[model samples]
Target: MLGGEEGIAVSGSAELRCFSAMASLLLRGIGTLVKSLAGLSCGQAPRCSSSSLPSGISSLQFSSTRCFSERPTVRDHPKRPLSAYIRYFMDQHVILHKQHPDLKRTEITRKIGQEWKALPDFVKEPYIVAANAERQKYKEEVKIYEDHLTPLEKKVQKAERQQKLAKRKSSRKRRELINMGKPKRARNAFNIFMSEHFQDASGMKAKEKFKSLFDDWGILESSRKQTYIQLAEDDKIRYENEMKSWEEQMIEIGREDLIRLKQRNKLKKLRPILKGPKVASKKKKTSVSRLKQSRKTAEPNEGRKARSRISRHEE
Candidate 1:
């Protein structure tokens, strides 16, 4: 009788576990459904028409698929046409690869470049002409595409392009500065404290080390924390002074673009003064005015003397 009761208890626990698992799955499905519904209500798409749905798939399935798909991105314009060199390279690359199957991609490309250089102008002429034609066609297509885009869309696309260009330029400038052995920025009080205590938490995980250090710093006495803050302030002043001299050197070397934006603007405003013709000072102007007055008085006196000499000669 006890064995039978123990078996019944085990079965009951197993059934409860199964029911709990099913309930969790149901809850997950309902949560997903709620998210999909919320996204759909936000007008992610104007409306999912019945005509647009597949014959076999229900509206629900189609909507779910749309919800899971990636959001639409900014670019929809036609890709730019290939250059003449690229056109020739694409045509020859496959042939070269086949001829030298053992060669790596880079080696194949080098061979293609050699062959292209050896080829007569006549062979290259056709590719160049084709590229020019395609370029013209691309320009016309771009014009039509731009005309179709709304003003807001055009602005957004322009902003996105500008952002990409600025990011590329900034990264390039940073690389150039690093290569030039640019001075590092100053650290804050927390960072200074972290560096000092870094070895203490060496055994901890990367994230845990940071958390531990942060907690320690948080509970630190105000007087002790002030010492780190003072060091940070001194380091900051050193960094600013060093950066100022470094930026001046960069400007002298004609690499003004690597300097800070505020400094760059200041340089721009002062450019005319630095590279322009010199202006006469107020002292120089005054000396010139006095010389002119002396000349005027002397000229009148000389005229009077000349008139007296003419009268004496006439008598």
Candidate 2:
């Protein structure tokens, strides 16, 4: 009986040991499955510790929350219309931000139907037409102003040029006058003029006598003065004749062109009259036929009266 009881106790101990081992294995398998499910759900590597599981799960939840917060959300609020946004952009940003702000905003907005009635038809139509017409008109106006500016600039340039030219001419004249005042230059010029004009002995003697008389008359620089006077007179006469000839030639050319223009105008006027000559010829023929018919009717009564008188005398 003692041996059987001992056997039964040992069998119970072994069965208890086996059940403990299976229970430990089942717990380990469930823990691994839980870890694998947690890793799969959180998109993270499996952790060894139960303590680490809560923190990892919490981290994944926080990460998901952060990602959701960072994403842009479609709002449930009603949106403003596109036209309103466009109008706001144009008026507030485009118009106000310009360096030179347009004062014609009201007119433009009114034409675009953004603003209420502003200008009358007469005023508005012309402005709209002018704005929408060919840009070439604006270009042409700009060109005209540019052309005007060019002439103005040219006038200023021409004035400056004339002033420079006058200054140069004055400087040249002064230099010539200073050179003429020099004793050596005056002497050379006098010698050249005398050799040319007074080559004969009588003319030379007369010049010498004149010089002596001028010397007696207290004229110290007679020779130079006389040469300069003679040169001035000759230059004056030559310049006058040249100017007169040029003026006459210019006038003659102008008259010829004028006469040609008048003749051209007369011929243009006569052209229509000459083209209708056939109409005039037909009218003349009609008038001549009417005159011949009147003459035949006037002669028939006289011939009848003469016949009647001749018969009475024969009877």
Candidate 3:
């Protein structure tokens, strides 16, 4: 009887474990379904519809499939490190697209994103591990390539890097020029100190200048920095309060687009636009009083020119 009872208890525990596993899976599936429904309800095409997505949003996925894009797009330049999420989605995108060749690229991407979100950590671990391995491999190869480069190659690489940086700067300058009305970020205590010494540091490269500033800041007594620090804190508070009020006003005014842009910090780059240098169509006129005085002074020269022209013709 004792042995039989122990056997029954073991079987019951096994059943409970099976039930729990099924329950967890069901919940995950339901959650995925709800998300799909929500995406469908929005009635907008998946954002990844285009071959090119916004920077830091999606990868430049080249498929043996359809083509779509919305904005002025450029090829990915100067590859940066990828995160685990990006790696997973990107790899999954190829497989899913190949399987459903007729589905829109954006549609596949939406499905992949949803699936990735639904996956338990354990299931994702293998992909993440593989991604990390690839990253390590890339780093090693890059180091080797750099080490093997000739002087010419090294110079070429440096020029390419500089060109990429210049492109980025030009893009930001354009954005700043266009969005001049965006609020300014408050300067901090360190910023004040830097402003005072900007002339001295102007000649240094960005990294060297920051290093020198750090050394100077380190030597300064805390008490002396306190006043500027307090001012910075106050300025930050003022900015935050103003930003909140501006956001409210934007909503009230029905400028949803501006609200989204502000949340994304896209508007922060805006400043008071400096108008282009005005070319005087005609030479700038002197003030009326100054013009009269100049006319009185120049009357003698005008008469001399007239006399010279008449005399030269006669001669």
Candidate 4:
């Protein structure tokens, strides 16, 4: 019985040793996996020790990823100097203005451009030399300006840039949303007629031609107008078909808000029908005037004062 008890104690110690060994192996495996994952992220960064890294990863890499996130601030970026021709124009413009003070800026600009075009190569060489010197000076100044910025300043600039980009994106999104659900107005009969013919309008201005076209269409006979009416009807039908497909596309894209907006605005009120512009005739007043005149004469005469003189003579 003493030997059996000693054997049981030995077995218990062996089982404990096995568990310890398995636990150590698991820890080492986990360490190796972490090191491998870290290596993938680090790229070619210098290996540096950190307390946060897993065991057996003394030579682990820690990348300075913040460098890639920095965007160049436009205010600090290099400025391109004015070209030789522009510098020449500026100098000549001042001198030319002293000689001709009444010249408008626009006229002066046009004149300068023309003169620059007319100048010979040798005449332009001096301005080109001056421009090159200014460009070199600008490059040096820009380098100094960028080198003077602090880390905090750079962070502020980057934040401002991100905000600007976000604002632009949001504005574009709003413009797209504002056109929501409104049907594209189809071209009417007059528009279709203009598009098919009278495209040149005989060199008339657009406004004048538009007025002329409408005036001509107003006088068109019923049969002539019917042709354009048919075209307009067909165009409206096509527009409706296209709008239906567009709504289906919106559904596919899961835009139920746009669909609801479309439904809400779908009901159209009937427009009042109007007749042609011909003036209505006035009612005849000649009969009424004649009756008034006859009554006036009968009262004044009264059978020549009721035929008193003639009847007296007969009696």
lDDT of each: 0.86, 0.56, 0.73, 0.76
**Model 1: worst 10 consecutive residues (lDDT sum):** 58-67
**Per-residue lDDT for 188-263 in model 4, tens only?**
8888877765775544788887777777788878898889889899889988887777776776787745554655
Compose the digit string of candidate 1's lDDT tens values, residues 68-140: 5564345588999998889989988888778878889998888778888899999899999999999999999
Q: Per lDDT, what order, best first?
A: 1, 4, 3, 2
What TM-score, computed on C-alpha atoms, does each candidate reach? 0.43, 0.15, 0.28, 0.28
Candidate of highest TM-score = 1
1-315 per-residue lDDT for model 2 (tens digits): 459889999999999999999999999999998775555533453334555557646444234333323433222322223333244336445544364366476655444453324436664554455444534465666566545554546566567769999999999866754453322222233444444545442424786855654443354377756765687566667655654454445345553222235554775688788786588788899999989988898789778888999999899
RMSD of 2: 45.7
Candidate 2: clashing pairs of residues:
none
Candidate 4's TM-score: 0.28
Model 1 error, position 272 (Å): 14
Predicted candidate 4: what Cα RMSD to the true structure? 36.6
Query: lDDT: which candidate is best?
Result: 1
- For candidate 2, give the lDDT of residue 84: 31
